[model samples]
Target: MKDFPAQYDLQDEDVLYFPHIPKTAGMTFRTILEDQFHNDDVCPATLNAQLKDYSQADYEKYRLFRGHINYVDIPQILSHKHLLLVTVLREPVARVISHYEYIRRMPGDPHYDMVKDMTLEEFAQGMPVGRLGKNVQTYYIAKLAQFDLNHLSPDEVFDLAKKQLDRLAFVGILERFQDSLFLLSYIFGWKPIINTRRENAAKDKKSKEEIPPSTIELIKQNSLLDIDLYQYAKELFETRFAEMQRDLLTKYGAFTHPQTVKEPMSSQVTQELLERHAEQRFLNLNPDISNSLSYDFVEPLRGTGWHRRESLNDRSGYRWIGPETSATLDFPVASDEDVIIEIKTICNYATTPDVAASLTLDVNGHPVQLEILYSDRGSSVRWFRAIVPKVALDNGRVFSRLTFRVNRVVSFTEVNPLNPDPRVVGIAVNSLKIFPVHAAKTESAALSVFELKSWRDVATFLEKHLGPGDKIAAPLVFQLKLPNEVLDYQTAFLSKVDFQWLILYKGTIENLNPILFNLLIHRFSPVFADGNFVVFTRQKQLPKLSFLALHVRALYEDRIKVPIKLYIIRQLKQIKSLFVRRSKQAETD
Candidate 1:
């Protein structure tokens, strides 16, 4: 099977419908859903209340439907098309205990106070009278056959739940989660989801052994229907899993699990190459950690503006903010202080002379007064500076959003009749930096800056700056022109050195290819600890490091620096000499 772009667009054109029952490892499964489908195609109805306003057209538009929804509760529009129903089931008694813990821990839940004072047994016994009791899984699944849960008998509900399991495209057992993930991947033609972190699990939750036996018995008694349903689901999962394993062997000629499939060596080399390129281009840009937090227009942490990355040349790129746009940058602050925000903007679309664009700046929802730092009409570049008061930043957040509202916007078509570009553009931002007013003054004294223009310059810079224990943590928040050859050589040189590398790239880490990046990270595991190299991204799946050293010889190729190549050769010769000595000693013995 090959990777299907979207499951909805498959030959059968089936919708991937997941009726998520709470506390059944569905949150972890959601990571896969998000990765597999586009955000616009996934339904936002997590609860039934969210689904109340959705019309048939709304229901039909989404390719994937998930969240805390019951199958029967889904709109009738879904019934007209081919549907691939899937769900995960946890062990009944365990599920009940987990749900009870979840409710007690989460103050946001409406039932939080209701079960706060009750003992585990009391909670189970008392709650069993309603729809969301010990048998909630059965309650959700049985409703598929008969929507009216009040009328269905316990036996009838259990039987219907089993029938629903028989009809499901796949049934996942939460205990065998990894196996379930692999099975689903093979079945659905998805890239294998590896190292998914569990989400939404209750804090300080107890194991089955921690609970009193009486409480366990009480939960078991209440969850009789769910226990039976879970057993059936487990059986179904096992049969399907075995069949899938056989199919995988028959198709691919081996047991193809995510753990078994190795990531390519080229991917690792490529990641190092890209990260190095970012580092060399922006090294020594940040004067100090406390000075400023910069948000490049190409990659703001969070914002409202969206179009596409615009590049004037290979050396520089920026994004156009429409009428209004906001860029958020986060930095640590120990005390309250006023900060200066610098915006480098260009208004080439300005129709009026002397007035390129009128921008109103706001910091953390508070209006700020802007001062014209400098304006150059010849280059269409304007530098606007503003001071955000300490009161505005005292909102108990480490980060502040700087919003820009422009008075005028002109499309390319509006600017020129022959121009086919229809993009509505306001002022284009090259850099957005926020720093404490005091730190801005002290930036010149913080660190020695360098402008390494070539491979020799980079080598000299590294030799001068990097010591035995020196940590080269380059925060790429500003733009600097550096040659492409130096970027590659700098990366290769750093790989040969005895220094800590904490290179940070502020842009979208999601834009980088995952397989390559993960492989690169795994390569660093030998020199550093588990978390030494960290790049903040929007994904929750942690990269699993492999122990494979198959790429050692690959690193000895032409890409490596000359000195490093010589060092490797010398090390290899020493290893050979040691072996020869050992052989001679054995002969003497």
Candidate 2:
């Protein structure tokens, strides 16, 4: 699909409409919603034939409407304006193959007898150009947007399909089942579940190697629209997931410095009391064993944030939080001297390093902070420690409720193909322990800082902050040699929300002109400026736009340092603004 830049705001009160595109995990989801949740307010339909039979009362009676319903006709049946549409999309080729296998397995179906002997290749070639077979997903999406597909071209259909998808509350990935379910949980405030079985699962599914190249190509050629649509959905999912993740990080991710609250033992102790503990070699060999416990070593995963086990494994009862999932532990905090929890986690990022998961320590039902886990290069063990403020504990309580949620997990089977393991193994946390930091008093107030000196440092810093959306102008170095020499001129660049660097260079107002500067072979022409404090405005109709408007300021010119510092500060501010805007945009969208 040609990129649809606009996104629709998925609002509350919109009808939860699930258009069950056949073979795209629809059966599995239906079983869970219908079989498992018998009391849920739902209007159900498993096949296309049932859609035409729905009445106005059917729409008004249920909160959830599930079917292999035509997207275009749902509105007409509903007699409503808003719909919180949701669906799962699969790989185009895999979906086609699954559709073929499912039809063959259905003995009661009318087409079953005729297609029992048909080869996958034959089926791919013979499947019609309508909503049931080739490019079926895209057809339904297009039909929903335009009410009919006959008037539009193939590319137009793709465009409309994407436009409709953007408005959806959630578009789940069939492969990223756990993660998708978590997104649904996060978006809808549903109790996220992980213990469900895969109902109506397909068996002996053929791999790409087993499918002939011609048959695969035939499917791909006919359903190119589905491929593009799937790709767009994937990107949208990642963006939305990342945005939600950042929120979780903000909500639960906290890093607290040493005692802002008055410490219980840091007060003055009387000389008489001190004499009572004097002179003995106080050899407490097994120190406070009662207070300290490790998650991996002894505690089974059976507490607050822990999900029930699906099938027992050697994993010591740990559940697969392949999505945004949480686990809770109760830690003893006797006297609140200082609560230190050390978490031992092992994860293999050999697969999707970019697709990392975040862990947030939630204390007393409040999210304290989140920590992101990413591999430096390969799979490895990570050690995380959360220091709970004594204030986190309830009045005179010995135990505190600690919940750990792996806020975000993204899986990419296509891009990196680097991680081939099927199950989205985020992080297998082995142990969580509560112990005193023996040197708690020695904890410093100052945070560790990285000082950038050389080009390499600058490069690293820039890489950490800036992405492709940003643009930087050279520092506006104006060494105005006045009639009388005076370095009294002051200058500082103010930060803007967009990723922009207004690098001002040496020149007077009248002498200003647009000079072309190239970055990675892309040409950028600086906006014409009159003088210092000149209002640089882009007319509402400028074709090309970049965030490079800057004010000229000439301070003591070192040539080596000032410009770089200015650029760095400008870039940093821009990055922060970009994140903020993105966060707000995500909430609305």
Candidate 3:
């Protein structure tokens, strides 16, 4: 169960499969694999000769099989060989553009010659345009599900591709190169190096403005399927990466590294390479400036020890307590710290004070001071806040259980003569918030997502305040809620912010991805987790961004806010489609 040999640990005889979808940073991943598995062992796999065609001994000898082949061409020996499936995905528009630019430079191919002198607009408007970058990524993955492209509708093919992606052991995002590398290393226990040097990246790439609007519109129009698939891939990438990070915490413990590692200067090999690379990637990503969100945003469903007693069967109905009915709540403390325990509850008693009952609240078996609730307030629901000293907590180890004993229930009918039944009901507990006393300050600064600029603003802030070696608290508490009110500060993962920012700001790849990786390590890690920030964004405005909004981040919207993430992704796709549709309509006119 140790984190080193992950739950998906590779066997000695395991076979790693890489469906090298073109322009997905596959060459970079392939290079990393070759270094780890020995160049001789990492063999090129092709459609002409699959694993089934190779002898058993040959298959056993080659640990890593990768090449640009049809997706469905996996060797039939998959059932017998332990297969570790992995791939990378890019933004559809960017990938398509990159593909065109790459092929546009080639002199040998007839297709390349056709587009060599012609502009992007000419290529788009040309007859038989389907041969170019239309749904190339989708076609690659869809082929895995149905060998014949005609077998399924485009939507059906995309759904199958996504369904199959969920089963993949790892799917890294090309836009999120460094973070993805860290995750792949963590997942497969490989020594991953940051290789920003892309293969087939044309020296003379066309600027976004240089490409005609008609061509750009056509690219979007033709690649809607790829756009959807890319989003799904992004979601999957972040999901598995979270699992890998959890494994790191389980095996390596928190904050084993507590400093911003500078990128290595012309170094040939690793360790420092990883540290520097990671540090550089995280450079611009500081969450503090984006908002005053604290660490409380994380909700630890497990290990933190907050639980509702299943034995009492309180889940099915309200925690109804008669005159003597008692209820207990338990919360775990990861580290001994002064915390204000907040409880939100709704009493069955409406506006009537017929329930003349006060429940005693005890923490760690001892009664604590809490404000008395009066039904006379006219509000049926109220929040009770109690400050508890750190020493008073039961925390003595990694996590100590803090028990809450509630009893002394008083019923309403006792005081109201007109009350029907005399039975008393205390409260139906709605939610609980156990946070450090100092976190009270972050509550007042619950800024809307609209108030914040780019995610870089948040990263820049976290880098200074919560950055590495700063002993504030492990996993700080923050209050981050999305405008949609679905993904609270806790459940949503935040690391993708750094990745998104990396893609947003362009320069030498050296400064962007590496420094963001640094931010991830120094500021974001010891594993920065929890629902700590709330993003208040309108559901209707999800797709549209300000002139300054990052289109790349918009493509992979999961890192922003949950609940409305789908809304944003859909909105972007819709807007793109509409823009294209209108442009075509104009051209026809």
Top lDDT hit: 1
**Each candidate's root-mean-square deviation in Å?**
26.1, 27.6, 29.2
- Per-residue lDDT tens digits for candidate 1, residues 279-331, read 22222343333535665544322334433444454334455655333332234
**TM-scores of the models, in the given order?**
0.45, 0.43, 0.40
lDDT of 2 by residue, 451-480 (tens): 213322322433443445544333211111
Whose TM-score is greatest here? 1
Q: Candidate order by lDDT, highest to lowest?
A: 1, 2, 3
Taking the tens digit of each residue's C-alpha lDDT, what string does model 3 give over 1-589? 1112333456676877777776677775765555445334565564444544566566667777776756444545455776667778888777777766666667764467677776655554452422466677776766655556675777887887777676666777888787776666655544334453344455576666877787788878878887888887887666665565554444333234424322221222233343333332233232222211121211111111111111112322123333334544323353346776665455435323333235456665656776421111233544455667766675332223334334444445554667674444444544455666666544422222225354335334444334232222111112232111112111223433221111122211111333333434543322211122222221232333342234434422433345356679999999999999999999999
Give the 10-residue window scoring lowest on summed lDDT in candidate 1.
477-486
Give Cα distance to truth, residue 546, candidate 3, Å: 90
- The lDDT values for all models are 0.56, 0.51, 0.49
**Any idea what lDDT model 3 has?**
0.49
Q: Looking at candidate 1, what is the lDDT of residue 54?
A: 84
**Can you list the residue pairs that collide in candidate 1?**
none
Task: Give the candidate order by descending TM-score.
Answer: 1, 2, 3
Better of 1 and 3 by TM-score: 1
